[model samples]
Structure formats: structure tokens, C-alpha cells
Target chain A: MRAKTADKIATSIIIAVAALIVLVLAGLLGYILYRGLGHISFHFLTSAPETIRKGGGIGPQLFNSVFLLVLTMLITVPIGLGAGIYMSEYAPANRITNFIRLIVEVLSSVPSIIVGLFGLLVLVNLFGFGFSLFSGALALTVFNLPLMVRITEQGLKGVPREQKEASLALGLSKWKTITSVMLPISLPVVLTGTILAAGRVFGEAAALLFTAGMSSPRLDFTDWNPFSPFSPLNPFRPAETLAVHIWKINSEGLAPDAAEIAAGASAVLVITVLLFNFGARWLGRYMYRKFTAIK
Target chain B: MNSIIEINDLDLFYGDFHALKHVNMEIPEKAITAFIGPSGCGKSTLLRTFNRMNDMIAGTRIEGSVEIAGTDIYSDEVDVETLRKRVGMVFQQPNPFPKSIYDNIAYGPRLHGITDRKKLDEIVETSLRSAALWNEVKDHLKRSAFSISGGQQQRLCIARALAVEPDILLMDEATSALDPISTLKIEELAQELKDRYTIVMVTHNMHQAARVSQQTVFFLNGEVVEYSETERLFSNPTDQRTEDYISGRFG
Candidate 1:
């Protein structure tokens, strides 16, 4: 009778903990949507921000946000994916592999604020990249790599071992098997990991301040060239990303219309993340279907 | 009977543990040979050694020599890829790749650079028909290979092995996972294929071995106990261990 009572209590506790987590997630999402939507308008989305009217659009900041996003994704995706494949496929389970995995895990748990400081000291101040879009992308990549690696490794692990063996047995060299069988079989998992990484890259802001800085007035589009640094013609110049824009408008300049800009920026950030998640999910499913079709 | 494969005092080790003792045997060309053994008798291990599939396992080492058609299979100078291309293997389970039936046959040919669509189509049709699976699956070339029944999948895998046009085909208890009908179909396919390819199979069923194999080799405790005609091995095995196993007294 006493044991039965203990079991009942344990079940109730587990249920309560689960419900509490759901409640918190739903509450946070609900509040953000409600508050952020009120400030959005076509003008808010398209127009440029002003030091005077505050009502002026977050045009430059919005541009910066888009630029920053593309840059960060471009840099992080290849690197994170390569690291994932290396860890999952090439590296055997041993002390060195385990140690590298531990380091990546620790990076994931480190505070975003500390990441910001690391970017400031290691990338910007020490390396002299300055307050540009380049620094912001570098910082975001740091924030994103661990999550990307972990997720990618998980996805690679999900591929069937038989598929790999079949390819190898057919006389395909190591590289061909990796490209033809392992990577393709594990692609859906990799894409899922990529989506999760993109989500992290989009939502992150605490690490960008010291790296990219909080400048919002100008439209520097020059950083797009893979080779060159920040030029006005280059979109790669550390443009103020969307999250940074929200932080800047809400805290600095005392612009009266700052609240509206923050709301609009917040909405855009949420929408960007949602689009990435939904689009990647669709792509992953389509690829899986195409590959799994029987002859 | 030309010796297509020659194992001269071959030895295999997993780390320090010797798994296959100094073993000597020869497999003849264009013949169906069966290796029958108790569990842990090294029949499967000996079969995998021909294609270097055992390279996938860490800490595995081989000594002595395994030669196929005068090529040293385990030599450092030998290209493992080309060696495997000439020696094809099918596993116990019907592990068809998650692909279209056409792609399943085309996979090996494509690797050898036969990418023209019409040529691929011909190979697919010919391979499937040879495996006796084309008539049933003629209308569904683009369907998933996995969607078929287990028996059909096993045949499809055989077709995949044939598509490569390998000189030797190895089956490791290939029918062990199938229903009786599927087993019979595969056994029939094996007999037909033996005319074109040297076939080596490891099977536990004595009846299956007798029905399909021309030559039979009985192994016990990492050594070959006897090698002779399948009928002779079953009816007049000279070795005590081979007799005991054939009589169902022990594996």
C-alpha cells in the first residue's frame, strides 16, 4: 500500500513538471506575439529609422539584419557541417574524439554574454575587425558551431550501418561512399541539424554587441564579396542584425518611437526563424521521400 | 577444374585471439561450392576474406595468403576496390538499398561508369530477368526496392550482385532470412547463375547445400574437415567431425 502511494506521487510529480514546462513555453510565445504584433505595419517593415521622428521605419536596421543573417549562415553552415561529418564519420570513438566532443558541448552551455565578451576580446579588440558586420557574423558563428556540430553528428548517427557497408562492399572508395551513401542517407538528419543551427543563429543577439557594435543609421551593403571586408558596396560589412536592432532601439537614443521599431524588429526575427524551420522541414521530408523510393 | 580461389595456410586474428587457423582450400571456377560448418567454425569469416569485407572491423588481422584468380587479395599493393568489383557478396538479410528497383540494379553498373540511361535500362532488365524476378516486378521498375516481400527483395539483391557482372559471387547464408518459397527460388537462381559465375555459399541447411552445390567443404573448429563432391560429402564423409555434423549429431 505504501509503495503504491509512492508510485502515485512520482507519477503526479512527473506530470506536473511536464505541464509546467509546456505552460512556460506557451506563455513566453504568447506574450512575444501579442506585444510584438502591435508595433508592426508596412511602414514599420520597409521604412528607415530616424534620430528625430522615432516613428521613421527601421529601414537601415532591417537591411543590416538581413545582411547579417545571410553572412552568418554562409560562413557557419559549411564549417559546422564539415565538423559534424568529421566527428561522426572519420573520428573513431576514443579519448581524443571524446575530448573534442566535450569541448563542443561546453561551448553550447556557455552564456551568450560570455560569448559576447569572447568576441570582443578575441575577434574585435584584439584582432581589430572593428564594429562591422564581419565581426557580428564571426560572433554568431561561434555561438552557432557547437549546436550545429552536435545536431549534425546526431543526424549522421541516424543513418543505417548497412547502407554504409553496402556502398563500401560495392567497391566505392571512401570518399564516394561518404558522398553517395552516407551523406545522402544522413541528409535529412543533417538538414534538421542545420535548421536548428539557423534558428540559434537567428535568435541570438547577446554575443553580437561587442563584435558588430550597435550602429543602426547607415546602409552598408558591401560585405557580400567572399573575399573583401566591409565596403558600402559589400553586404558583408558587419551590418546590424535584427536582434541587435531591437536591443539598440529599446535601450539607446531615447527615440520616442523606439518601442514600435523594437516590436517590428522582433516580429521580423520571429518570422525569419519560423520560415527557416518550416522551409527546412519541408526540404528534409522531400529529400527523404526522393531517396527512399524503391526501384 | 581451375582453382579460382586458393587459400594457403590462411590465418585470421581478432586482436590476439586467432579465429581462423592455418587453413588450406581451393574453390574451383564456375562451380557452386558450399561451406557447411557449426557456429564459430569460420566459414563466414573465410568467405568475407575473399572480398576484404572484414577490413571494416577494427582490430582484425590476417596472415598467410588468400589468392583469387592469381591475384593476392590481402596484399598491400592490391587495390581493394578492383578486387571487390570482381568478387560480389550478398548478406544473410535481403538488404536492398532504399531505392527504386531500377536504381538497385543500376547502382553497381553506375559505379563502373555505365551511366547512359538506355544501357542502364538494359542492364536492369537483364539482371532482374536473370534473377527470375522481372516477370513479377516488370511493371514496377520505379517502385521502392524495400516495398517488395522479403523473398522478392532477396532476389533483387541477387540481381544487384549480378548487375556488376562479377566473376565470383559469395552468399553468406543468403536464404536464412527468407520463407521456404523464397529460399527455393533463391536456390534455383543460384544454380542457374553458377554457369556464368563462380559461386561460394555458406549454408547451415544440409538439404539446401545438397540440392544446390556441386562441391561441398565441411569446416569444424577453424579447420576444413573435408572437401569433396556434395553427394560424397553427405553420404561418405571421411572425417568423423563431418559425419557427425551431417548426421545431425552436432553442428
Candidate 2:
């Protein structure tokens, strides 16, 4: 075959593959919205589910998902950033460092269901935390921490070597050079990765099933005190996130409109994750501009 | 003129590779010294040793002593940070922080705890003027360092190095990446800077060494083959290798 003809064939195949991916994504999104959008309303979004009734809502589950995400991030960000900085900047390349990297890679690839089982065994039973939001957040941390560390490490490594050299040659302390020069340049990548991880936390179900539990206590939204048992802010209370609620409703929900509730909840979950992905891109670009002064 | 930097039997190794062998020289204060040699011949490596920048490289070892202002810089008592503060370096590529023009100049000062706004402003102005960049960038002090042209960015880097008021300034092929006009501008700036700061430069261009430097050192295979006044070395080279190199016989 002629080289030009072969090149044309290769280009078409590549475009067809890319188009197939976009088509699949669009079809999935269209089907979910078509089945779920009609059922969505302010009442459906803000009211509690009816266990045996024809009408049900996912208000508390939605709030639980958001709250659990915030809690997990509060625990994960500091630990992840610290570990990442050490791995990228401070840690010498040795057997120990390589072992730590191997552990992180292994941890990230662990099945979410396995993580849930482990959470049930350790956090719920051994630690005596019970099936609470705190336990779920901890479980999610195990799932998300590896990702955050890898992202931060890669981001820091992406910074130009000359930037670090320039800062050091100016007599800046090692710590100052990292915090002032390196971190700022890598912030966009780190921020985007953090939000992408947050999206994972939002849509995660299996990990939360055995840790956060499949039921929420009657929540008092007006009770802003974190220590109160009934307050939504309480991390110790049993909570069901949107993804878990969708799973439970689809499996054995007693409600007559269980399928509709599941569909609607799934749609909401998808929308939230999509929003997070877009937000990460936009925020990353915005930060890069703010930090670097590039238009 | 009094010598400010003295090297006594200095040798450097990058793992198994001997980079600099038995180097000895006394560099005068407030003058320009240029190291001209072929690539990988240790001109840049010797420049890095002045501020211990080579310490960042893995498996890099050194012997003998390098003294600045009569103190052995390799001694345990000499803080690397303080040593670096006294000796500033500009690299081949212009590497201004991804920040405003003003911030790039003020970065060194801020690191050493200079936070007063007015004082930082004065340092910014004077440093820029010293680098001959003040008039061009005065109206755009808040602009990003990358917003300017490449030549301006190189000048901005020079300004950044000058902001800390170092006694010794090292330029490692500082204009190699620049256009001819920018290169000429930097050469002029180096000539002016040597009146106050001890200047050392490594250059691939031999004419650059002859044009700007007072003392010229020629290296071959990690050893200095010639060290003398630039005029004498170029016009009346004593060594056969130096004569061949200067007359464009070979690297």
C-alpha cells in the first residue's frame, strides 16, 4: 500500500476511536438525564425519603455526601501535601523511598470493596467508631491519600529545575525556596488533583457502605453545633451518601418509587462529579494565571 | 590589587569522573575573570564550586580548599547559605520566578528578611538600574517576568542577583541563549559591574572573554593550561595549547 493511503487510514482510525468515546459518554449522560430530570424538583431535593410511600427524596443523602467530602478533605489535604513534599523534595532516592512509593502505588490500586471491608473490620469494630461519618471519612482517606500524594509529587516535579536553582542561588533557605518558589508554581496542578480526588470521594459508594452505614439518623439542619448528635455537622452520626443511597434503593428499598429515586440520585451524583471535573480545569487555569501573570 | 579568592590544590570529582584536577589560582577583587574552555572541560563546574552549587549533584566529591575573603569556604564553620549570600550567580538561561518584575528583583531581599515596603522599592530600583533595565521596565514593574522579551528577562535575572548585594557575582554563560544585541548589552553590563563586585564568568565565546575579562583562564581536559591578563593570553600566549585554542585551531 502507498504510504499516503496508509497514513490516511491511520488518521481516520484514531479519529473514529476518539469519537466513539465521546459518543458513549454523551449517550450515558443523555439517558440518565432523560429518565431523572423530570422527577427533580425543590421538594424532591430538600425533603426526606418515604420508606414505603410512592414519593421519595434524596435531600439528606445529598447533604451527607457533601459533608463527608469536606470532612475527608480536611483530614487528607494536610497529610497528602506533607507526604508529597517530602517525597518530591526532601526524600533521598534510596531503598526506603522506593519502598514507600511502591506502597503508595499498591494502596491506590486496592479495590474499593476491599477498602470497605477493611474499614468495617478496623474502623467500625476494632476502633469502636461504629458505622459513623468519621469512619467513612477515614476509609475514604485510605482510598484518596495515595492519589493526592502522587499528584502533589508529580506537580512539584514538573516545576522547572532552573526556578529552584535561581531561588537557592539567591541565598533562600531550603524551606523558603520550596514554600515560596516551588509550591506556588505547582499549585495549579495540586489544586486540580485535589478537586479530582474530591470528586472520587463524592461518588464513592462501596467504601462508604460498611463505614458510614446505609442509614442516616433524623438530621436537624438548623443545629449548627458539630458536637450535637442530631446536627448534620456531627461526624460521629450515621450517614448515607448519595451514591450509597442509590445503591441501597436499587437493591432492596421498600419504597414503591425506588427505581425513580435511584435514577434521580444517580443523575445528581453524575452531575456533581461532572461539575467537579470542569471546576478543576477552570480553577487550575485561573490559578496558573494568577500565580504566573500569564494571560 | 588584592586577591579576594584563593584556590589551593582544588580537585573535583563527579563519582568516578575527575572534573577538575589540581586547580590553583588567586582571583583579584573588583575585576572580571573569565574561564574559557571546550564543553565538559570543567569551566562551569569550577564556577559552581565558588558557591558550592555542585553540592546538589549526587556523588560529587571535592578535595583541597577554596577560600573567599581569606576564610576556607569548605570548612564546617562556613554556612552554605551565608556563603551563597556573599556569592551570587546568573545562569545561561534567564530564570526569573513566575512573578511580577518587582517581585523577581525583591525575592532575594525578602528571603533575608527585608520586608519594609519602601526599602524593597529602593533595592528594586537600584538593582534594575545596575542591570541597565530600570528605564525599560519602570512602567511595568507589576507585570509578570515572562511578559517581557527574552533579553529583558535575562537583565531581570541579573537584577535579581544584584538585589542581595553580593560581593562576588558569577555568570555561567549568562548570554549564550541571547541574541547578539542582548549579548553585547550583558557584556557591557559585566564590564561596569566589575568596578564594585568581583566578577567571574564561563563563556564558550573566546572573543567575549577577551573583550570583557581582565584575567583569562584556559582549561583543557579539566586542567588550567593558561592563566594571565586577557591581553597577554590572547596576544602573546605562552602555552602551545593556549595559542592553538585562541587562534581558532581547535577547542
Candidate 3:
């Protein structure tokens, strides 16, 4: 065969593979929106679910997902950034550091279902945290922390060596160089990773199932006190996230309109994840510009 | 001329590999001194030793001591940060931070706890003026440092190094990555800066050494072949290696 003809065939095959991925994604999104958009309303978004009734909503579940995400991030970001900086900047190339990196890689690849089982055993039973939002947040941290560390390390590593040298050569302390010079330069990558992790937290079901529980107590939205048992702000209360709610309604929900509720909740979850992905790209670009002082 | 830097039996090693062997020299204050050599001959390594930049590398060791301003820099009592502040350095590549022109110049000052806005602005202006970059970039101080040409960025880097007000300036082939025009500009800037700051530069171009340096040191295979006045080294080299290397017979 002619080289030109073979090159043309290879290019076409690559393009076709890329097109297939886009097509599959578009079809999945279109089907979910088609089935769920008609059922969505202000009442449906804000009201509680009704068992044995045709009308049901996922309002509390949505709020729980958002709240759990915030909680998990509050726990994860500091630890992740610290560990990452240690790995990239401070840690000597040695056996222990290599072992730690290997562990992080192995942990990230572990299945989410396995993480849920581990959470159930340790957080719910052994630690006596019960099935609460805090337990769920902890489980999600286990699932997300490896990714956050890897991303943060990679981001910091991506910064040119010259930048670090320049700052240090200017008599900046090691801490100051890492924080002011290195962190700002690597912020875009770190921010993107954080948002990607948030998207995972939002759509995670198996991990939350055994940790956060499949039921929420009757929540008082107006009760802003975190110490109150009935307050939505309480981390100790049992909660069901949007993804878990969808899974439950599909499996054994007693409501008459369980399928419709599942579909609507699934659509909302998909949209929120999609929004997160787009937000990651936009925020990364915006921050990069801000840091670089480029218009 | 008063000697500001004195190196005594300085031998440097990267692990088992000897990088600088038995180097000894006294560099004069407020004058330009140039180290000229081929790649991997330890000119750059010796330059890095002045600010202790070599400490960043693993398994690098040095014997004897490097004294600057009557103080042994390698002693345990000496602080690397303070030593670096006193001895500023420019690299082979132009390394302006990914920040606004104003911020890039202000970065060094801000690190040493200079916070008053007016004082920072004055420091920025004078530093840029010293680097001969103020006239070109004054109007667009808010623009990114990367927005300018290669030559302009190199000047900005020089300005950044100058902001801390160091007593000695080290340029590790600062203009090697630039065009001839930019190289000429930097050569002129080095000439102007040496009267205020003790400037030590490493250069591949022998003409650059003769043009700007009062004293020139030639290195070969990790050893100083010759150290003398620039005019004498070029016009009447005593060593066969230095004479051959300068006349382009061999490195």
C-alpha cells in the first residue's frame, strides 16, 4: 500500500474513534434530559419525597450532596495540599517516599464499592460514628484524597525549576517560595483537580450508601444552628445524597412514581457533574490569566 | 583595587566527580570579573558556589572556604538566605516570574519585608533604571513580564536581581540565550553595573570577557588555567592552554 493511503486511513480511524465518544456522551445526556426535564418544577425541586404517592421530590437529597461535598473538601484540601507539597518539594528521593507514592497510586485505583465496605466496617461500626454525614464525608475523603494529592503534586512539579530558583535566589525563605511563587503558579492545575474531585463527590453513591445512610431525618431548612439535630447544617445527622437517592428509588422505593423520581434525580446529578467539569476548565483558565497577569 | 571576594583552595565535587579542582582567586570590589570556559569546565559551578546555589543539588561537596567581605560564607554560622541576599545571581536563561512587570521587580523587596507601597514603587523604578529597562517598560508596568521581547525579559530579570540591592552580582551566561543586539545591551548594562556592584560573569564568548571584564579567569577540565587582567590574558597569555583556548586553537 502507498504510504499516503495508509496515513489517510490511520487519521480517519482516529477521528472516527473521537466522534464515537462524543456521540455516546450526547446520546446519554439527551435521553436523560428527555425523560426527566418534563417532571422538573419549582415544587419538585423544593418539596420532600412522598412514599406511596405519585408526586415526589429530591430536595433534601440535593442539599445533602452539596453539604457533604463542602464537608469533604474542608477536610481534604489542607491535607492534600500539604502532602503534595511535601512529596514534590520537601521529600528526599528515598525508599520511604517511594513507598508512600506507591501507596497513593494503589489507593486511588481501589474500587469505590470496596471503599464503601471499608467505611462501613471502620467508620460506622468500629469507630461508632454511625451512619452520619460526617462518616460519609470521611469515606469520600479516602476515595478523593489520593487523587487530590496526585494532582497537587503533578501541578507543583509542572512549575519550572527556574521559578523556584529565582525566588530562593532573591533570599525568600523556603516556605515563602513554596507558598507565594510555586503555589500561585500551580494554582490552576490544583483548582481543576479540586473541582474534578468535587464532581466525583457529588455523583458518588456506593461510598455514601453505607456511610451517610439511605435516609435523612426530617430537616428544618430554616434552623441554621449546626448543633441542632433537626438542622440541615448538622453533620451528625443521617443524610441521603442525590446519587444515593437515585439508586434507592430505582431499586426498592415504595413511592408510586419511583422511576420518574429516579430519572429526574439522575438528570440533576448528570447536569451538576457536567457543570463541574465546565467550571473546572473555566476557573482554571481564569485563574491562570489572573496569576500570569495576562489580559 | 580592594578585594571583595577571596577563594582559597576551593575544591568542589558532585558526588565522586570533581567539578572544580584547587581553584583560588581574589576578585576585586566594584569591578567586572569574568570566568570564560567551555561547557562542563566548572565556570558555572564556581559561579553558583559564590551564592551557595550548589547546595540545592544532592551529593555536592566543597572543601576549603569562599570568603566575601571578610566573612567565610561556607561556615556553619553563615545563613544561606542572607548570603544570597548579599550576592544576587542571574541565570543563563531569562527567568522573570509569571507576574506583572511591577510585581516581578517588587518580588525580591517584598520577600525581605518591604511592604510600604511607595517604597516598593521607588525600588522598582531604580532597579529597572539600573538594568536599563525602565525607559522601555515604564508605561506598561502592569503588563505581564512575558509580554515583552526576549531581550526585555532578560533586562527585567536583571532588574529583579538588582531590587534586593546586593553587594555582588553573579551572571551565569546571562546573555547566552539572547540575540547579538540583546547581548550587546546586556554587555553595556554589565559595564554600567560594575561601578556600583561587584559583577562576576561566566561567558562562552571570549570577546565579551575582554570587552567588559577587568579580570578574566579561564578554566579547562574543572581547573583554572589562568587568572589575570583581561588585557594581559588576551594580548599576552602565559599558559599554553589559555593561549590556545583564547586563540580558538582548542577548548
Which candidate wins on TM-score?
3
Descending-TM-score candidate ranking: 3, 2, 1
Against the hidden reference, what TM-scores do the models get? 0.93, 0.98, 0.98
Backbone clash pairs for candidate 3 read none
Error of 2 at B93 (Å): 1.0
Assess candidate 3 and give its TM-score to the true structure: 0.98
Worst 10 residues of 1 chain A by lDDT: A227-236
Where does candidate 2 chain A have its weakest 10-residue lDDT segment? A286-295
Q: If ranked by DockQ, best first, what sequence of candidates would result? A: 3, 2, 1
Candidate number of the best DockQ: 3
Residues B123-179, candidate 1: write the lDDT tens digits: 999999989999999998899988889999989988888888889999999999999
Candidate 1 local Cα displacement, residue A247, angstroms: 1.9
Model 1 regions more than 4 Å off = A1-16, A220-236
- lDDT score, candidate 2: 0.94
lDDT of each: 0.83, 0.94, 0.93
lDDT of candidate 3 over B87-198, digit per residue (tens): 9999889999999999999998987999999999999999999999999999999999999999999999999999999999999999899999999999999999988999
Query: Once superposed on the true structure, which residue ranges of model 2 sit more than 4 Å away at CA?
Result: none
Ranked candidates, highest lDDT first: 2, 3, 1
